[model samples]
Target: MSGEPLPPVKRVVIVGGGTAGWMTAAALSRLTDAGVAVTLIESEEIGTVGVGEATIPSLLDFNRYLGIDEDAFMAATGATFKLGIEFVDWADRGDRYLHPFGIHGRDVHGVKFHQIWLRQSRLAGRMGQVGNVSDYCLANQAAASGRFTRPVPDPAAVLSSFSYAFHFDASLYARFLRGLAEEAGVQRIEGKIVHVDIASDDGCIRAVELADGRRAEGELFIDCSGFRSLLLGDALGVPFTSWQHWLPCDRAVAVPSASTSAPLPYTRATADSAGWRWRIPLQHRVGNGHVYASAFIDDDEATAKILDNLDAPPLDAPRPLRFTAGVRERLWERNCIAIGLAGGFLEPLESTSIHLIQSGITRLMSLFPDTGPAIAERKEYNRLLRQEYEQVRDFVILHYHRTNRTDSDFWNYCRTMAIPTTLEDKIALWRAKGRIIRDQGGLFSDDSWIAVLMGQGLIPQSHDPLADALPIEEAGRFLDHLRDVIARTAAAMPRHIDFIASHCRSDLAA
Candidate 1:
């Protein structure tokens, strides 16, 4: 059975007005051209958790789909380019690695690049020559040297090998997108939702009531209410599934600090005692936050740890955020769909906060329903989003679970704790054959898994046998040539700060 179908979605109401709401509004505003109305409700009194300062390359596609100008968006949001995340002390104290945004090296005869590098490095007398896997990646090289450039479309060019994202002010990004969405005929209502009205016959959300005695009705409802889940959870009675046992860091203290140096073109996730701290470099300030497990450390201690670790003076007192690492059991329940924090939060370990929101919006667009009671659509969306969330969850858990740090109870528990069976299987496969088996349609690429697994010191038991097709001497020469070309190409690129200065400098800090 194809399930029931009702009237087409005419008016779409989005609850909340942070990055999620505006991003949803902006994306759905395109529907207005097809005679669909989009309305967004937000309260000025309730501030947003605006600390999703780092993003992945997928955001570039989201912005492009919305027809946003790259330089203008960057300038408005005080954004700097992001090659990838630099993980510090994840595997153990004093360890560092880059989970870069592009491929490692050119695969020879359909064999994966890492397998070749793995085979060559494991051979006697070639360990020093091959160096770390990071050496073969262009993104890693550029990030290490503070270089930034837009990738070329030419497959032959070394510059085409890597991609980039952004480090921007989340609040400003919301505001920037708000202007676009509003300009595209999206209506905005300023008010707090005091009640959600559910229909009797069907469990679909009928409308949302504001505290100021206003009612906004719509055929379709999107919950971007950030942790509140006003429509989906509160009214529709959808339940949340907690992943805390696997991902235990439940609290975060975030603060903005003055930029001490030129902004680096990447985000930094440094391991802390109770959890981990993030360092995101924007043009104006550095976004710093300590995400720690409250069970092992108090709020005061977490705040102090972040303050003490700052490279520059604080711009504001630390702000605290509380959340469970989980998602709603069903992302789309009935006619009400949840996006962003309202749907779930997997932490910002991989800088996936915004990406998840974008993913939801994209999936919705693809499975966009013209009628009410979109049963098949909802089922597919829930399945896709659930898979995406689990994929990201496993990747995040890998950082915490694969660590060698035993200095604190937090690390000890994380290191010794049992992980999900899915993650276990992935790790086991990697251990067996240096092969990264990524789920189909997963957010992260095989290169991403390779980076984190190898960075955290999880080497495979053996290389792919296909890597042995090429002679050892030939493979060594190929690695040397690739490394030299990447180094020279990276050196030739403009500095990250320089690229921003010439293209998209906000000048807000100055």
Candidate 2:
């Protein structure tokens, strides 16, 4: 097997044309410098599912790799900086919390900061003065204050401790990337795929037949065909695995609304009777959606729920989408690789849709294969992506299952549903002792789990023994000083809207 290297790939073909397709195309276009030909096929008649998107901080790395200017990208997408997600009523009615982007206070002498804070909170006298854990998070405080600023390079700076993502128009982001991808020599074909021809010998995709009878062939095929999974599922016959029993929300109704005020620096997810509502603020409009289990709530009620909860008048009629909360049994099959919805979905609850796409592309690039047999590469790719999806799946399910809501059947089912053993183990560890063990390559950090666990009223029975190393009096003083520093730093930043206006205001917004 090690005698000689396989031939290099010369042509790459991508199916579909939304955020996933364009992102893949744009990223792979760099290979054009080495004479690899990249082509993308899509139909104008097909519409994309994303209305507005909330992203995580990892996108910054992807943009940097693509050489995208922050200001230019924001302006092109009518983007608003996002520091975190504000979850309302998830734990119980009237309960709320913020899952911020960065770490919560600095760790003290190699001891986790949360352990120290948890230990301090347990003290009867210091409970009120120490304040909520949110006080120690810069991103949380800044988001609550509607402030925005880029992180500083100095790690010691309070301002540099937290990170920011974005709330933007997803279609516009795809359009922006389309321009970049095309400029970098990616060929876009305007047509729908009518058929996929599979080679008889290896059962690999040979070429895609278009409605107009044109055929596009390539050595490597990328399946970004959204939920259709045209190449990977349809052509290669990969089976779909459903995680609906755990994550029961199966339908969503999304709509855009006029902005009543300045855009906040975070996305909002509010728990509802049957499901939940998401409000993502962009520079030009507010994106609202209701994700509900169709078994418990009808489409009309779900749609009505979102409409009634909007802060401003509607800009258009509501759009509906249906999906199961699961991933494919195998993301990489034969010679075709699935990215985005084609691979699987864990819903947009944590704003992980776009991030998943980025993860798929990053993984593919790392294990990019040549024209010869790629069995080992394919297995590794599938393993990595499957782990990522499950990790994200467990995180998302934590939001629903940890809830105290009993007002609706949907909540009842979610609250009592059987969860994957992986999530069960995670929650068990945290409940016993305030310890968070992150799986390798997991998307969320220990801080994220801490935020949600505590936010959902799942405080542990005890703290780490090491948290007792600091004297109570000294710990209280440190907590007081850190809280004050975070509050002051956040207050010093400009308002979210003001920062965008000065740096990256879109013409539509202007």
Candidate 3:
């Protein structure tokens, strides 16, 4: 080893200022020592694509690590608790199922809970007493009843099996984080980036020239420039790999509408002819959007579909967004790291957009190069990020590929399209035996995979052989007891709106 100590990274510069940019700034500001200086530059002229965002349960960890109070954060963002996502009409015109946030029934005698349920369900089907899979899930049951409660820390508790996330106004969330980041010493600059200067000798970013004739220099750069990908794509020339062939909804029309009723503790994604529509409830309004392929439907028609399907009258004109489903060939290149929409985009099908940003932040922090960017660090970061993206891509593809909906050309194409070999193997494994291959560092758990697979109507012919080892009478009793426990626990929870009103109600003026 060299006698001289490695130099520390002194200055870090971030581009853009939406949820991604602010999230990066807030995290680094709170985590990094005073030796590092964090600065973010953004322009008021650029409008943010701030649709209502639905997140997964992992967001709780992100906030907790940053020491943010959950109730305070929710109030600032006009947020609502989310138990799970209810997918409607994906399998067939009238079919519905929930992809919940947490586990289902408790495991029995070393066999997975789902396996036991599968066996009992099969037997029940024969006896004409089959039950809806939702009854076995605490989150799904709570969601159905419009209830919400935080999970107890005790693993043995029935309520502890469930987890929760949030539905919040993205713009408000950005503003909320901006306040925190600024308080933690993140300097915010207001200007459009006119140019990105690269070091002639190393080809790394040296400084960004603002439109106001000023330049901001830094040793490291974080690109949160949304889909434009200013630093990574336009400057570094990183190539994008499009997954449109496998996942093809490329356009979305978003609008907010009046809330017609008490907000449910879940997001609703309903399938349409060309694509699907999303309904995310917030304290003040309902966020509605239709994600569809432009080839099959026009922008005007897509907007009309969204407006027509909204639960209430529009609050404003619909906004349109266009994006391709894919990520850059490498997320980290040289001294610059790309996060959020700039790194890539997978449609909010499973509401993974913000979670991807959170993951990127966490990974960057874990492999943080205090001595400046190293090739090895960049390689490992890119490798891990690629795995994360691919894992989510495969899960999203499962929803489309396994669907029985043959109602439209869109559905037909999705059902028949060739998929990644990774996804193909997963489907094959599940079909052969009810086994879900879990990704070690993946965002979605085995329960998530099981929910989507079974919710979409794919049933394995056989479960784990160990599940059958139990006597039928015993297994049936275990199943009955589990269902009863979950249902009763869910019934005792307060209504979602009541929980929010009492614990985290927004103080924002109408």
Candidate 4:
């Protein structure tokens, strides 16, 4: 970029159509100008592993950027509000905790609420019963009590900033985004990528030959072809860096079930002998899945576990999905970029699949590739995507490694396995002083680390000293106030289901 003109890679072809494909389409349509051409080629024949229905709060930004109507999106996607994720038995049998969206209570006396809570626990000399920090967190309290609302917190207060995400049918979301992107000038082609035409000397893909024998050429290519990675890996030969050793869960069996009970405001992930089960409450139905280590469990056993653990009667046959845990060595190389499952797969242990896809799209926009770069830009882009993936990977691994469970071989293995050095350092720092070190490019925030670390029983050796600055009686009053305020605010919100009924409900929701 040092005086060199941005190389023109005007025509772009995206090769797939699920959440990733349409998400890419929606973003590109917004960025590309009138003359620039964007074509997306996806066949209806190939099935999508459309179980990526849960998301993080950050998705609000994506929707806001696209100016997508919230009610319309909800109606089209059969969406339910997601306040957070509930981890059941991750630390030990029968234990449950939530990793809520948004921040916890307001920092008091320039100290985090959790730190103050830690000090209060020490003052009370309560041993086994750790302070329930979430008791004061707005989103957590609201989720616990089945409440939902658009936040209108006072500028000086903490609860005002509570955030939320959504649980929607993935296929419907893709369709919804497809409409947005197409209406914004993105051309959609229905076909399979039979072969990738590449420039022989540079090895950069030039076009994709559709099964219909029509040639769709582009100066740049986006590979959203899911696991096959048609353009990036399959055609271009980009290497994949596997992380199967650290994240042992390689397969999942997904099934939708009829609504059996009132939908929970959060996703529920329950631990088991071989792996874990996810219950995502969509407005109309529940998306259930069992993700397990294929090495330790068979398809039948895995599917059985999923069916046995379902909260409602099965609505459809279970669908199996398989993948290794890792990312493409280079998400972008030459003129091609890989997004979504083509880029990597970290178990949705934290509902990060959509988040990571968003990350890739955002990063691609920032370091948007051209026919030529300064060489440094490519290096920087690769470094950033690599770091993003590693940071997210480690965060997911922390849940498995920081736990106290040992009831099964899966649990025993996870409990003792060595983790990434980066995660180990973070854990060590938190234990030493209850301090969290944030990676500038990392997606997870300090509060996020605290929530998971404390939820999984990683008690810090010492509390934040700032907490000691306040007198014990004063701290008690503040903590009580925080708890009471959260209770009242959450109580004032509409019931979770009622919120949808009154504000966002539609034919899909029913």
Candidate 5:
């Protein structure tokens, strides 16, 4: 009897090596049995788009799934915990809001917190606008105060019950995953894939032909070839759907700058004339990028805009990247599956790039076939991947479309332009009823849309009628009490810089 555990995926080939490639390999290696053979091929000449330094709370699950040591990973990557993102000047100008990780506040008398706040705002002589939604969220408060503390194990402290993620060096993270993938019996091939050989009978990719005349054959092929898309797009011929109309910022200029005095525990995205600039603080340096549409701004100006907006002195030359913002019509073609830039390029506004890659790898693992790739399996993979990408794309578009900024041509287009009907319907419903169209497939929660909608000055026409069931004075008192409690709790926490220094600081930060 064969000792092997039934040979689930005997051979697997990964044709890329950046964060996406390595992350997929590392994850699949950990999840599958010993009989599986995973191979990753890449060229030293190729470069990775590694500006994705900031992340959301979903990373907690991915890290735990990878069995990564949190402190070690943070220290190695020069990670700073991110509670949420602060959007600057997005509504009109000089306006801001933080899109936090968790819920706003505890519901009272079985009523939604925002509805209660809305009810209070209607009361005569109410001083506060009650629109500062982040106050009730511990993570958002922690971010605003420039403080960080792991939720204490005690259940009573609301601070201990909150969530967070990391802002770190993307390159360092790739190296970390590479090490794990290699240790788990993944064969790392160092060469450029010059060609993909195909089988005559099935037309599936038979093997990847490297520049050095080496052929890497596998029963199933994964194209992680970044924008080159060597196997799935170039060889198998899958069409890509361009979403430039919906997500128009097709160019990006990224630069890393020396750290500000001490790194903060959150990422900042400030709206600009052409597009927006992202500021991600790591231990030793800050990652900066200006994403814009080339139609409105030239390369020289965009580069200058990015350089002028840096938090510190430039540490390296600015690198520019151009991409058509969209996903492939088919993520998996024949026996080959495309991941990362090969799959599609959605802007990293919410840092969904890595998360999408992780999800793709996981879905593949779940649908792992004993034989060659099946159409049913491929179809399901594409369905989930399309939904995930579209959902994130729509959410990112909301930030731009709902804005009141008509200062620049770019902003004017974003503000007045027609958007996806799905998004329009969601916004229209919220404006009338203060109710979010909850969808499980949607990446953002009701709290998220509420933050952006309210931040962009989209208040509901009227408060939730159900909230009227409570006495007017009682509703006002509850709202005031929650706000006070949140403020007091946040005031008692340590500074974010101090929290990192005490718990997660490594040689990188030191």
Candidate 6:
């Protein structure tokens, strides 16, 4: 290694201009104290795939990091609160479950709360007084009752265990972030990139030549070019590893519908014959989509199904999207780093798309390199990003693979398909006992795993042995008390619509 210190990254060029690009620019511009000049280029003619509207709780961290006010952001995006996702008809035809944003209940006697819940549930089943698992979860109960409230900061409070995200208009969110980015001294260039000029000697990107004969040059390039993967895939020639065999639902038809009633404090995902449909309620309208495998059902049929399922008339014609589920072999290659859809795509089964984007941006910020490329830094960034992608991939796969619905070929394939060894091990452990292996870097926590596993009828054969330390009757009483507390707390909360009106309701005229 050279003894001389490397120069800090002076100029960064971000290609594309949707959520990914703007989020990257806004984050770098605000977070970097070294005064790295950031420039983002995009053409209004090139429309973005703004379908990832529903988000997870981690989005709060992203917003907080950027110093965005919650109420203002919600109003600007026409957002509604999201407590969790309700999976309808997933495990069985009539079965439904809510995967809440928080844990089931507080741990008892140093054992996981879910373990105690399992033990109590088994006992209750024997006594013929089994209760719904969701009853013990504050977020689940609140979502079920169309209630909304900010979580209490004190962990001792019954409502403190829960968290929330948002359902918003993706296009509006991009606009909001763009304003933030531009205000933070980030330059915005409006143009379509005609060509990327590569330095012949080092094979690094030199500049991007726009259609208007203007060349924007930079030392580092961030690719947020959506599925086209402009700089990373086309210019850098990074190979994409397609996971179509595992996640075969490669097409989606999305549309906005008029809101028929007060927006619920959660998202709804109803399983269909060939795939699934999502309903995300926003303040102004509802976002709806059907994600389906083309091999199992044609686009026309999927579109028809989605249209027929809409709660109200569609605001516009259904827009179709095509994608292969997988990530690039390397998210960071040479001097270029790919974020968002350009990096890879896993279907939004659990509303993880935006979170993945946030994770990538955060990781890139953490491993931000100097003006001179560092091979080691690039390798580390790629490794972390790959891990993130794989972890999310496995979690999403669990939803599909751990199913008993064989009414259609798609469902049958998903039910019988082989899964990644990581997921296989996880399933095996859960089946053997109510244990969740925590991944240090994974997005979903143990509580999330437990919720999905139990929701999808993948109940463990027995509770964790540690849970047996407590008497069976004691555990049952504890669960009953917890469920009652959650129910009463949720019942006393303000209605979701009323909460929005009181705090973050949007003035469309503004």
Q: Identify the candidate with maximal lDDT.
A: 1
RMSD of each: 1.7, 1.8, 2.1, 2.4, 3.2, 1.9
So what's the TM-score on candidate 1? 0.98
Model 3, residue pairs in steric clash: none
Q: Write the per-residue lDDT of candidate 6 for residues 418-458, one digit (tens) a residue.
A: 88999999999999888998987889988789889989999
Instruction: Give the TM-score comparing model 6 with the true structure, all chains together.
Output: 0.97
- Candidate 1 residue lDDT tens string, 1-510: 234556579999999999999999999999999999999999999978778999999998999998899999999999999999999998999999999998898989999999999999999988888988898899999999999999999998888999999999999999999999999999999998999888776777778999989999998999999988888888888889999999999999999999999999899999988999999999999999999999999999899999999999999989999999999999888788899999999989999989999999999999998865688998999999999999999999999999889899998899999999999999999999988877988988999999999999999989999999999999999999999999999999999999999999896857
Clashing pairs in 5: 146-496, 147-495, 147-496, 151-160, 152-160
Off by over 4 Å in 6: 1-8, 31-33, 124-126
For model 5, state the Cα shift of residue 159 in Å: 2.6
lDDT, candidates in the order shown: 0.92, 0.91, 0.89, 0.85, 0.83, 0.89
Model 3 scores what on Cα lDDT?
A: 0.89
Candidate 5's error at 438, in angstroms? 1.8
Stretches off by above 4 angstroms in model 3 are 1-7, 31-34, 124-130
Worst 10 residues of 1 by lDDT: 1-10
Q: What are the per-residue Cα lDDT tens digits for candidate 2 across 1-510?
A: 333444467889999998999999999999899899999998888867765389999999999999999999999999999999999999999999999998899898999999999999998887788889999999999999999889898988898888889999999999999999999999999999999998776777778999889999887899999989998888888999999988889999999999989999999999999989999999999999999999999999899999999999999999999999999999888779999999899888998988999999999899888872488998999999999999999999999999889988888898999999999999999998789999998999999999999999999998999999999999999999999999999999999888999999998686
TM-score of 4: 0.96
Off by over 4 Å in 1: 1-5
Residue 114 in model 2: lDDT: 94
TM-score of 5: 0.95
lDDT of 5 by residue, 1-510 (tens): 223233234688999988889888898785347577889998888767666788877778788988999988988899988888889999989999888876788767777878777767767677475646676777777778888777766666676647788898988999998988888878899998888898676677778888889999887888888887888788988888999987899999999999866777778898888888999998888999998999889999999999998877899999999888998899988788888889998888877787788778878888876755576888888899898888888888989998888899999888888998888888888888688877766778888888888888898888788888988777666766777887788888888888778777879755
lDDT of 2: 0.91
TM-score, each model?
A: 0.98, 0.98, 0.97, 0.96, 0.95, 0.97
List, residue by residue over 58-131, the lDDT tens digit for candidate 3: 89988998789999999998899999999999988899999998887878778888888777777754344437
Model 4 pairs whose backbones collide:
153-160
Query: Model 5's lDDT to the true fold?
Result: 0.83
lDDT per residue, candidate 4, 1-510, as tens digits? Answer: 134344587788888998999999999996567467888988889967778999998899999988989988987888999988999999888889898886777787688777877887766454434348778778888999999987765867655657889999999999999999999899999877787887766666767897889999887788888998887788878898999889999999999998877789999998877889999998889999999999888999889888988777899999999999999898888778789998888989899989888988887777775563326667887789899889999999988888888778888888899888998999998998798879987888877887799889888988978888888877787777877887898898889998988878869655
C-alpha lDDT of residue 136 in model 2: 94
Relative to the unseen true structure, what is the C-alpha lDDT of residue 296 in candidate 6, on a scale of 0 to 100? 98
lDDT, candidate 2, at 430: 95
